[model samples]
Target chain A: MKFLSNLINGISLGSVYAIIALGYTMVYGIARMLNFAHGDVIMVGAYICFFAIYSFNLNPVIGILMAVVVCTVLGVVIEKLAYKPLRQATSLAVLITAIGVSYFLQNMAQLLWSANPKVFPTIINGSIKLFGGELSISRTTIVIVLVCALIVVGLSIFVNHTKMGKAMRACSEDKEAAQLMGINVNKTISMTFAIGSALAAIAGVLMCCAYPNLQPTTGSMPGIKAFTAAVFGGIGSIPGAFIGGILLGVLEILGSAYISTELKDAIVFLALIIVLLVKPTGILGKKIHEKV
Target chain B: MAAMLEVNDINVYYGSIHAIKGVSFEVNEGEIISLIGANGAGKTTTLHTISGLLKSTTGSMSFMGTDLMKTPADKIVSLGLAHVPEGRRIFQGMDVEENLDMGAFTQPKSSIKGNKEIVFEHFPRLKERRHQIAGTLSGGEQQMLAMGRAMMSNPKLLMLDEPSMGLAPILVDEIFEIIKALNKAGTTILLVEQNAQMALSIASRGYVLETGRVVLEDEAKNLLNNDSIRKAYLGG
Candidate 1:
């Protein structure tokens, strides 16, 4: 019964990471740059939602939508202001700029909202009991898992079937060639960031609802963990992110429940090291071939 | 023949080094015009500039009456112009059909079906391997895919850069034949080639580019027989 309960909790947590990791992976795949500030964007999304619902007394659904909208716009603005100019710059320079952006966002959040932690409201409350109350599952877990499934399926269809989605894939492979094909490379890249940040916003709200703790630093740890999940599953593969996140969550929860709570994160990182040493490409990362 | 594309004194630079110095040429409607040059003779650069991939320091470029210099590279295709770049830069990560779909990026979805049919008619091999990843295809098939992908836009003028590059001799003959057939079907061709003989053979007119300058311009037959052109380019 405990094992089943832990598994459900792990899935609920994993779905949040998967959502956040999707943003990281997509941005990395198309922009060819690590957006280190992604986690901070989640914090921003949470704050937006917190204010919209708690302060403004808006409905939870409206708060979530507003968060998604704001995050999407913020993403486009960040790309234009910070990353676009560094398009031709070296990877190291871009990495440093991303780190800078991350710090900037964190500091901005601290200044705007103050450093105090707020209790995030229970947006969805209730639990489902199975097997005569031996195993219980939270409604939030069901919602997060369903939302994650929908996002994964919807994103797959969009990338495979839509015109703009194909353009994004084409741009990732060869931007110059995509330009010749009459694809607006810059616009496609901006769209990628937009989509990624919107996902980040949802991840933020879901994470806060599950844990019910809102603070400037709430997004950073989960953001890094989701990034690890992305790398674990094969950074650029959509299915990989989902798998990686779920596995990471399961591992973390099982480690804490069975072994030591303080050592769960360490166990997760150690497992990542071992997996990378074995496969190097994560579970689904394609072996890139250099064309002569 | 009415001029479909006109360039008046365009100079292109890579940083401080001038690659194309005051180069100018034009392609008439429904004619195969060849730009024959050795390596680094600005053939690809000229094509890049006209397609808006590379900006010219000074010049006027008009394609179907639109000022090409002021237009974006991606917008050039909708104005009925297409370029098959040097080295067949087809989207290698995508499948054959996905690559074709990308080729029709600027076209309407309703027209995509018709455009794809036109492409398949030209290269039936692409249709057979439509689901296969592009990078896995043979060199000749990749070249065919590149040209067929360009044709997906249904452009009035098609610029081909080194369509014969790094292909088997038999494949080269096959590609050239297709170029002639495409031209016969009323698509204006601007062919750039290092293989001077094959380029001039099918072209109605030829421009012999030497060190970023159009050294000689004449009818294809005259350029094929010119003593200097034969010596420098045709390996006489």
Candidate 2:
């Protein structure tokens, strides 16, 4: 019974990671550039949502929408101003630039919002119980799961069926050929970043609601966990990221309950290492054959 | 017919190495023009320069009397110039239909459906495997997809580089047949090929490039029968 309860908790936590993981997967799929500042962007989103609720006294729904919009614009701006100028530079340089941006955003948040953890008002205060084991699920957790599922479905449809999605797919496969086909590579890349960041922002809001605690550095652990999920499923595959996130969440919860809480992150990392060692391409990733 | 594309003394460099030194040529409208050369003979470089993938260091390229040297690669497609790069750079992860749709990215959304119908009409095989991932396809199928993708843009001039690099003899014949059929349908083509015999046989006019220079240019039939071209490139 206790195991079942922990399992539910794990899934709820994993759902949050899955939402954040989608952003990492989407951006990495198209641009092949690891935006190190992605985690910080999550923090930025949380802070924006916080201010909207506390400072502006806006409704939770409006606050969430505003957070998504602001984060998306910030993402676009980051790509245009920071990444675009260094398009021709080495990958290492771009990676370093990403790190610089990450630190810059983190410090900026600290300066603006302070380092103290601010209490987030509960958007979903109710909880439902199930089974003899007393399975309790929060409204915030339900909303988070539903929103993540919606995003995943929406993204899959966009990539599989729509015109812009097809263009993005083409760009991910062969950027130069897509350009020859007259797809604006820059615009597509920018749009990818914007969408990915917006998703991250939503994940941040749901996380704040569930935990009800906000800090300048709250995004770091979740971002790393999402990245782990992205790698576990297949960095380039959207579906893979979804599965990976949930799996990670479950594993962490189970480990904390049965094993020790101190070993939770360590155990997860160990599993990741073992999985990677066995299958370098990941569980769902396809191996790319380079032509001579 | 007026020259659809004029390459006037274009010099292309890779870092400091002069890959194409003042190479000049003219592609007339509605004609199949073949640029035949050995490895590293600036055939691909010339195509890249004209397609605006690589800017010329010291020359001018005009397309339909418009200065095309300064135009970006993506914009060149809308200007009625479609480039099929070497190695058939198809979007491997996408399906056949998706790859074809990408070719029509510059056009209005309304025309895309119509263009897709035309592409399917030309290559019925692509229509069959419209939902199949391009990377999973055979080399010949991939080649067909590449050509089909280029045609989807409805360009006035189509540039193809080394379309027969790796394929079975039958697939090679099929590709050449498609090229001739495309030409007969009134689409001007710039063909860069190492298979000189087949290229010269189908081309209206041919140019032999050697070490970044146009060593010879003549009617395809004339070049086919020429002693030097026959001995060196045609394997006579």
Per-candidate clash tally = 0, 0
Candidate 1 docking classification: medium
Residue-level lDDT tens digits of model 2 in B1-236: 55899998999999999999889999999899999989999999899888777889887889997889888888899998998889999988778987888888888888888988888887888889999988888888888888889988888899989888899999899899998888888889999999999888999999999999999999999999999998999888
Over the stretch B127-151, how does candidate 1's per-residue lDDT look in tens digits? Answer: 9999999998998999999999999
Worst 10 residues of 1 chain B by lDDT: B1-10
Tens digit of lDDT per residue, candidate 1, span A1-292? 8998999899888999999999999999899888999999999999999999999999999999999999999999999999999998999999999999999999999999999999998899899999999888989999999999999999999988898999999988888889989999999999999999999999999999999888888888999999999999999888999999999999999999999999999998998999899999999888756343
lDDT of 2 at B114: 90
List pairs with backbone clashes in candidate 1: none
Model 1 misplaced regions, further than 4 Å: A288-292
Model 2 stretches astray by more than 4 angstroms: A290-292
State the C-alpha RMSD over the true interface residues for candidate 1, after superposing those residues.
1.4
Local accuracy of candidate 2 as per-residue lDDT tens digits, A15-110: 889988888888888998888788888888888888898999999889889899999999999999899999889999999999888888888998
Worst ten-residue run, lDDT, model 1 chain A? A283-292
